[model samples]
Target: MTEQPPPATRTQAQRTAATQAKVLDATVDALVELGYAGTTTQEVNRRAGVSRGALLHHFPTREALVVAAVSHLVDRRLVELLTRPRTGHEDIEIIVEAFSGPLFDAALELWVAARTDHGLREAMIPLEQRVTDALAAGCADLFGDRYTPAELELTVELARGLAVSRILRTADADRALVTRLLPVWKELLDRHD
Candidate 1:
């Protein structure tokens, strides 16, 4: 009988990275499902299927985990936006939806929590800036002179406001209003070119 070689073992770094990824992904999931107040380290550890020791080894504090998770999420989203197929004349709704969907909801939980938590606010400010920069870069790459910087920024802000309103259940995000505004927004874009 032939002897089987020993099973290939993962390097320590690979194991560490895998653990961090699992924890971060679980953090985003918890944030999405439970919001900031409800997402505890124990909950994240449970969802990640990692031991508390492993979680603490990677992220010593809850704030560290929260911040790192958001950074991870934003980086992933920026990559998705950059790599996604784009039509030259896509509708505003498509862009709005892309910006304000599930990922945004997850981040919104962090933002709402940061409003009162000074440490979280400090951590979130840099993350917010990074996301904003990534979005601006992505918009430029995708649109390519179709809209000016100010116009693109305004569009992003509008989408965010709509998202926040929807999150608060204060706005229905009426499709009719969006439908009516799309043509006008497109016309504005055309005029800017």
Candidate 2:
């Protein structure tokens, strides 16, 4: 039989999507490593190995790029949380670790910046709402029929509080402390269940 033709090259749309994804990933990395103030388009371009023109074509402004990046990050994290294997015996430590990791740090940076920057805040509101919806969905998926909607919402809120406290440095999130306090939080959640 005659050999099949080689696979068609990537279309321009595919290439554009790939480049946009790279820039968005680089933006997340910069936010995590350098905080909001330091995550400039120039830095993202360098990290993503894409030209400034490409970035501009994909995202016309820094705020637009950052908003897209945060949305992308939150979507990815929600997927991870929803799909992660659960032992049905998870503790506060595990939950905290899950919520207070690199993604949280990057999101925290954006949140803090949004608090003061009107443009950023405007951009972030919809993204934050999407994240909230995803978390609600994730909680329902995780707990299933064991808990009511209100209970599931409370569980998500409790975990978010613990994670936020750690990110904000208002609470001691050390393993020892988390271990000691986990059971108490679980008991509280059990009451809701």
Candidate 3:
């Protein structure tokens, strides 16, 4: 076989992008294990096997890296929420059902991290608003003229509360009780009248 030229090295930009991604991923893993307050840029750099200078070169500040990691995590969850199958239920019920399971777990985890981490609050508020807006838009589509602005806001809040409750009470709450109470979610939409 003829000898081939050596493979070209990755470009500087490509290497930088890869390193940043590694840093972001490592940050997320650290956050998941230790929460936002516990994760540090140094720890992320160590986990990513990149130099501290390389991480700061890409992110410039710890806040920048933390925001990037939060955005990265939310983007993945948003993709899942967007792609999930809709069962064609009423808007409020759909909202309840949509935010269940791992999606809810992730939100709770992120919120808990945000509570203690100032950098996380700066990162999460806008991301969370976007998710709420997307869900509200979907609700508008489902409910059409029947759903008013105030009700939509309440539904969204209720969904968040329910998700939080689920996360907080998962251990003690009875699954059957939750299943039976699911129907009561529609009362809020009905009250919108």
| Per-candidate alpha-carbon RMSD to the true structure | 2.5, 3.3, 3.7
Model 2 TM-score relative to the real fold: 0.84
Candidate structures ordered by TM-score, highest first = 1, 2, 3
Which runs of model 3 end up more than 4 angstroms from their true locations?
1-13, 85-123, 141-146, 171-174, 190-193
The local distance difference test score of each candidate is 0.82, 0.78, 0.71
Estimated TM-score per prediction? 0.87, 0.84, 0.71
Best model per lDDT: 1
lDDT of 1 by residue, 66-182 (tens): 889988877887777667787776545655876565578788888888899999888888888988888788788777777788988888888787667665453445565666777
User: What 10-residue stretch in candidate 1 is worst by lDDT?
Assistant: 167-176
Kindly list the per-residue Cα lDDT of model 3 for residues 8-82, writing each as its tens digit: 999989987788789888887776676556678878978999988888888887667766776676567656655
- Candidate 2 local lDDT, 1-193, one digit each (tens): 8999999999999998899899989999999899999999999999999998889998999899988997787778767766778899544344455567677888778888988999999988888888778766665666566566776566666777766677545454556566787788777767753
Q: Name the best candidate (by TM-score).
A: 1
Backbone atom clashes (below 3 Å) for every candidate:
0, 0, 0
Q: Write the number of the candidate with greater TM-score, choosing between 1 and 2.
A: 1
